[model samples]
Target: MLFRMRFIPLFFILLSVAAPQVVAHPHSFIDMKMSLSAKQNKYSSINYEWKMDPMTSADIAYELKGLKPDDPRWKQQEAIIMANVLMQDYFTDFYYQGKKVSFKRIPDSYHLEKDGFSLIFFFTASFIQPLPIANSHVEIQTYDPSFYVSMTYPNIQQITLPSEIAANCNVSLQEANITDSMRAYAFSLDKNDTVDEDLALGKQFAQRVDIQCP
Candidate 1:
């Protein structure tokens, strides 16, 4: 059974202190890295690593204080975090040949660790149906729809592919095109403010990963 959602409090608490007065939409940041794995010419699973910024990490650490790895509370905390991401579809938009793709959660793959002052979340999810990659195009975008948190891959090298398909596939990163109006809009919102969910403010600033295999 999935754990009850307890991450909201943590999220809101972090956001409350993430920015002062002038900061824009993204109050917290997560550095992301992903690896794509394949089998029998079909893309199968994606492994994700998200490194929380120091401020966010500190908040999380305080919440998890004195909890040992073997503590049941540790697992509960992990489940809560995983559920938070699952509620958002893992913050991923995947497409194959222009059609949206779905994913299945791999609960056993969820884990967390500390990296210096940062906290890193690690998880894996498989496509509901593996997507064929031979002579096909695939696109993946990850972002926080609410724009409260900024998720980004620091560089193109952060994304990796299975070696067997690496040579056959051409990959590129498309940076988000943030317009002046968009910047202004983000700037106007304070930490307590929220953008309409329908607006998908974060998607406007999402970086896209495009892949083609010939």
Candidate 2:
């Protein structure tokens, strides 16, 4: 559910951190397909395909509605989106054995295009250390903390597992566990301010995938 109703003004506010803040609420909805692939039996990368809801796309396109596809406006918008996401670690989190996995590479080159009325973003977040098959259990989640944008995984069956590994691997999706106190605190922020990361309000509401290789 979208917490806030105002769209255009809120969109611009989120684009610029320096802009006047409002209580953070979702103005955009994203359907995501994420895949985990391995190279030589080690986890290599996490790829993302995000499809923005048509309404959100139209909201973002409001200014450049008539611009040519080759216009600099499109490029500028794409750059802005990339910069924002990069600054936020691509809205992704990964863990192995309860420790966070640091992403070593976030490529500058990404695919952005207008798919019918919606906008699509595709990219991969790579890690410096490949997760060994012996790791056995790993978890990955993606979300935007402030709730300015809500991200949902379209299907758990779409997630890929390491094929070359000897053990049987299974993938499962779990709903985020948001507590009453955390929920109350999250809504209290105004001007786009977010609760402390320790509360994990967004993560608690995000779609999480648990990988087990036995």
Each candidate's lDDT (Cα)? 0.80, 0.68
lDDT winner among the candidates? Answer: 1
Per-residue error at 183 for model 2, in Å?
Answer: 4.9
* Candidate 2 Cα errors over 4 Å, as ranges: 1-24, 62-73, 162-167, 180-198
Task: Give the TM-scores of the predictions, in the order they appear.
Answer: 0.91, 0.74
Q: Write the per-residue lDDT of candidate 1 for residues 79-161, one digit (tens) a residue.
A: 88888888778889999999999898654399878787788999998999988889899899998887777889999999999
Off by over 4 Å in 1: 1-5, 9-13, 16-19, 105-108
- lDDT for 208 (candidate 1): 99
Model 1: pairs clashing at backbone N, Cα or C within 3 Å: none
In terms of lDDT, the poorest run of 10 residues in model 1 is 1-10
